[model samples]
Target: MTIGLMLNALGAGVGATTVDATARDTPSASSFGIGAAIWVLISNLIGLAVGAYVAARLSGTSDNTDGTLHGLAVWGTTFLISAVLLGNLVAGIASTAATSASSVLGGVVRGAGSAASAASNVAGPGGLQSATQGMVDRVQRALSGGGSPASMTSDQRNAEMATLATRWVTDGRMTASDRERLNALVAAEYNIPVQEAQQRVQQAEQQAAEAVRRAEETARQAADTAASGAATAGFAIFGIMLLGALAAVFGARRGTRDVLLVRGTGNVR
Candidate 1:
């Protein structure tokens, strides 16, 4: 049982490494392989000795039957020991990693959403609103000593918006209908035409700003998930090996005793 438990742990570790590496498309997925192997070897050796000693003591007769029983005892105890000690450890670590990953994923999604929303604020029913908003945001972004959104001069804000609207119209981001709508809204708000409205707002600013935010958010989320998965897998493997050792130890003792009894009765019969 002890040997079996050790083998089981080793096999499980290998399987986990293979699966993780394949899934992640990374070559270093099994970086902890050496550590896991070493733990198994050392712990199993100890379990084997303990199991053999216990089995010998339990067997009343020193015969071939008893010898066989001892072997079984050693195996069983090894498994039991490994399982109890390692299982809990692995579970705790894996849980922590999973939690971390979840947190990272949530943060990334929230960041992305916020960026999209910020860009959307500049867009209006007509291209005019979006153009105007883009200009205001850019000027505000560029201010020295960073005062407030209200700090930009009205003329500077107007010039920026007009530049943005023209760019939006030319870039195919806005259509004729969009321009017309923008003009109507501008005329209603400031008695200006669609052309004049275009001069008031900018287009490239909106797409550029949103794009940058989206990229950053995506990268952060990916990194968080990767780190979490690595931690979880390492802890889970450690726990499994420890538990397996425990199972092997206790199990070996019982098996050995049963075998000895069977042999003794057989010899008498």
Candidate 2:
């Protein structure tokens, strides 16, 4: 029993890790498709042999229990243990999947930033070009101060404009020129008249926020599916190994009985 347990634990750990690492998006040093196939064959064979031998010896009864039964027990134990451990070990990584998704989004944002810069340079004077670099500096500062004009979901940017406009109107803090410019920014951002632009911004913002939430949910489902498949495959392999071991044990016992009969002169010359 002890030997069977140890062999199974060791095999499960190595097998599960190999499967998990190869399952990632990163390139693997090993030819995982081919290597996994070959390793699975050899590992199953080795596990079967060791498990059957240990089970036969520890079955510890001479009451003529079937060798196949003992062998099946060995395989069943291995499969159950592997499934439990692999599932538990992988649970933590499931939660971190969102972090990987966020990184992908960040890459997309960087690509968009480069495109925006190039387009700005191409448009030159008519590109809604800032009168001076200092104006660009102020926009950058406002964004850097945690109010990114570009990062806002369409609705968020709309909400931001509404708040700004409300302050301009209600607080009497803006010069007429500032309100006009603010109105123009909102128009350019939403592509509508100042009043209509505000409503469109609100709608777009709501839609963009909903889209992001849906995307995150989709990502979570994909991650869960991948994890579940790996675990199921692992358990399936363990079961196959057990079946093979039982066949080996039965063959061994039959061979032993046949040898004894032949040696007793039942059919020997």
Candidate 3:
């Protein structure tokens, strides 16, 4: 039984690796296709069959039914040991894969949180509203040809605009007062007309919406791929195990017949 388990593990590992490598090298080849499944089944069947034959021969059973029963005992013992080992291996692999996926997902979530934080910060004390009011007062002075608010540095103006944009994204839609204030700021900063500033704001909003949609789609695809891979692996494991039992029974019958033939020939001699 132990020998059987070892042989099966080695055969399965090699076959799976070979199939995976071939699929990687072939353009458009699927890793979890029928070929891979067939290889796994064949490898397991061959290993179990060899084990069962050895067990029957060692038992010295002349009756086919007796040999078959011995083979079944061998199969059951091997199956139990294999199941325990496979379960441990699977648990370890699942833990590692889950950790990796969680790390990646967490990174994405953190980035999204950062974006949200930036937007929320705009509503805090001494935030976007205050910044926008300061910029507006300066713009009004500049438009009146005062040349005093022009003393405000370019860095200050840029920071104020960035804060307003972050707030706009989080809010999803601008209030009437925010729209008017933003329009005035843009017109003053770029020397553009108010109508052009409004158009620019609308374009920015559309781009933000598209970005959100893309993020959602990417997350969904990752989840689907993980689910499909898990399902395929589970089904393949079950099928290989079932086929292995059938092979063990067949091998025992063959071994028993061979023993009976040898004994009869000896009597004739």
Candidate maximizing TM-score? 3
lDDT tens readout by residue for model 1, 1-269: 45547765776666566554446753354555765566666555555555565665566545545655665555555556657878989999999999999999999999999987777766545676768789888766543321222444444445544654677746847666545544444444565665765565334446656876898899999999999999998886677655544554444444443322435745842
What lDDT would candidate 1 get against the real structure?
Answer: 0.60
Best-matching candidate per lDDT = 3
Question: What TM-score would each prediction reach against the true structure?
Answer: 0.31, 0.37, 0.52
lDDT assessment of candidate 3: 0.73
Residue pairs in collision within model 3: none
- Lowest summed-lDDT stretch of 10 residues in model 2? 252-261
Per residue, candidate 3 scores C-alpha lDDT tens digits across 155-188 of 4445556666777878876788667666666666
> 1-269 in candidate 2: lDDT tens per residue?
34445655665566556655455754365665555556555555566566665566565533335555676666667667877888987886875787888899999999999998888788686654665566777655444422444455555455556666576547645566545555555775665778875565456547756876899999999999999999999997767665666655663343222212245556563
Which ranking of candidates, highest lDDT first? 3, 2, 1
**Higher-scoring candidate on lDDT, 2 or 3:** 3
Sequence-dependent TM-score of model 3 = 0.52
